[model samples]
Target: MEQSFLAYLRGRTRSLPSVAVGIGDDAAVLDFPINGQPTAVANEPGSGVLQQVACTDQIIDGVDFCSESQPLASIGYKSIAINLSDIAAMGATPTAALVTLALPAHNATEIAGEVYEGILEACGQFGVAIAGGDLSTYDGPLSINVTLLGTVTDPWLRSGAKEGDAIFVTGSLGGSLAGRHLRPIPRIELATRLRQIATVNAAIDISDGFSLDLDRMLAASRVGAELDIENIPISEAAQEMSQTSGRTPLEHAWSDGEDFELIFTVGESDAIKLEQLSADELTTAITRVGTVVGRTGLWKRVPGSKLQRVFPQGYVHGETDE
Candidate 1:
């Protein structure tokens, strides 16, 4: 097996497809639209509407998730779904996706099409189109990266959260190990509806669990939060599956990572309207489990400590000292 393969192909050749002008230059001219933008976009007035936000997530053969033993189709669908969920988190509607893949020689034929079908099916159900993407070979573990573009009248972000805001999360958390991880619902429409009724300060998709993601939100807004662990939504599915753990199934919803729900904060100004809209628009319950407070700093309401204890356990970014 090839240990590492990352290089650039630099040259123009007769072998190039007519659709591709030159990839080795400042930019690769393609026969297709990038991010679903039309060649005529420059002519559009008022800067073409932001059709969507583009994001990418990867699942490598030995990292991010499981090894190749996982079902090829599920692996494929999930690769695309993970990125789409980001669009959904911000209340954005995905209109298209681009899928790029790399794999060991033996893994290509076995997984590529199955993955594309996953991408295509997700696009169909979610009302997105497949514009185009690049396919290639590598000498390493399989890696699938999907770049998704979505459109929302207003795209939500983590910087909007503010002090005195109400923090709410949709749907139950935890028990993903029971299978929610393999297939989780994208809260796209719910987010769109939320945008209409709720004046959001900030928003983030819960890919890395609530605590870590929320930490980012709070940090961005320069605020601290107080969470009522009892009020946190725990999935009935998670409770049924837990064997032994003191952190409570709620912790998984709180910090397990990859639940893919949206963790957004709204000010009290819109609380009542949100309640009314949520009733008509959501299948899952949206609960305001806490509030943003003065910069007493980032903390969780863990028992035994003061009512507001610091949460230092959110996901941290680091591997080890080289």
Candidate 2:
């Protein structure tokens, strides 16, 4: 339904000339003019002007969190952190955010204050300023929305992936719902350091399940992937969740959403350079999980078993896996 609705919107909506990227990748990049001069062309290297990157996300009570049990501040932090993750995925520097709140009529003032405390905490940690937004008391559950703005000279796009590229993911995957989902550590510094060290062909954040988000990148790049089951990093939380969930830790790593890690592709030489880096140097553990293939489907290689096609399973808002 999300894809079909997005397709419908794409069919009807016409993008303006200034829109560098619209409704496709992590964020919408716009080629805003700088001092009467147009910014460098989209996807081109060595652009003097910074392209504007914008993204917005919302989290609601009950759906994103249990308002009764969880701290309101954490919920607010998550609202901004998710958008920051989007900005980090674009390899951009987040500058500011506009926060909007939909508060319940009961204890609205106290709830708003607590949520703002979380929002402010995240913004302070990330060096983002709250620009402006709207607030309203409604008859519904608490909801928080954040619109993040950033700038980038050379944006890493999903379509940039090519055949023979080595796929890598920062940090472990799966079982973020154990409590880490609310306090996401956006890889802004890591992404910047990565660009400085090597050429990143394509990049994306694992907001949904790893398989689903990786599939989205592959679809954009018009390529396929062959993953090694053993190489995929399964988190400790995933292991714990697997015990009673009747699924393997790997299955949780593959399809569990809200990991917020980064999955990227690089060339063979660059991949070697990245792999050689110690954990202390990168400040994050990155694993080489797969290789980009020429075909157009996701495949996994299991030990002793033949290569098998795998469905991209993950969180699909308002829809179930078919």
Candidate 3:
């Protein structure tokens, strides 16, 4: 259901009809092909996708996020955070956001205020402005839809990754289940910095866990990946959580979704420069894990063994009755 909705939204486009020219030189009318530019073509400087980072996100009540034991502010922040992640994945800076809300329960004005405040805090963090939005009441879980506008020239797409590209990640992966989901750090800042130093051929946000998100990139780029398990970074909290769940550290490190970390590709040479510049100090540590292989699928290295595709498909969120 989620996939279908996304597909419909993606194909939605407003168009204006063009005039048909009269047959001129040879009994044939020529209409030059106008290639569809990146999704950011509609954006303008200082406003929307002046470059190529157009973002949109939706949060349903019982599913996308829970209202129980969660503050309204956190919910609002998360609503924007997910959209910002998309912008960051494109290596773009978010400039504007439009938030729409559907409120089912009759809550106090204070709750609404707190939610707005949370959204405002997120906007302040990323230099984004709340342009405008809509509000409506429904008979279901509360839902928030945020569309973030960003800009980046020569924007990175999941399809740009070619064989031999080195796989690099910004910040520690996983550990998000340890309260990281409430306010997961969008990789926008890191992505912007990476653009200056790394010749990032392809990239993505580790929102759906390393396994699935990587698959998204794979599908887009039409290639597979090879990850060196020993090299992937692990956070202390994630390690502990893994033990608690009777799982391996690698499982927590690789499968914990909502890390909000950047997993991007860079040429071998620029990867070094990116490493040096990032060593100074980062909100999160960057790590190099693997490479793009001619083999067309994702894989992980076994201890003292061969690299093999292991991790299964990552998280899928929607109205499924799981």
- Candidate with maximal TM-score: 2
Candidate 1 wrongly placed segments (more than 4 Å)? 1-52, 67-69, 245-247, 277-280, 300-306, 312-314, 317-322
Any runs in candidate 2 off by more than 4 Å, and if so which?
15-18, 36-49, 302-306
Backbone clashes (count) for model 1: 6
lDDT of 3: 0.71
TM-score of each candidate structure, all chains considered together? 0.77, 0.95, 0.82
Q: Highest lDDT: which candidate? A: 2
Q: RMSD (Cα, Å) of candidate 2?
A: 1.9
For model 1 the TM-score comes to 0.77
Ranking by TM-score: 2, 3, 1
Residue 192 lDDT, candidate 2, scale 0-100: 82
- lDDT of prediction 2: 0.89
lDDT values for all models: 0.66, 0.89, 0.71
lDDT of 2 by residue, 1-322 (tens): 7788888887777754547778878898888776787755554533545788999988999887889988999998899999988888888899999999999999999999999999999999999999999999999999998999999877888888999999999999899999899898998888888878988888899988999999999999999999986899999999999999998999999999999999999999999999999867987899999999999889988668677899999999778743
Lowest lDDT 10-residue stretch of candidate 2: 40-49
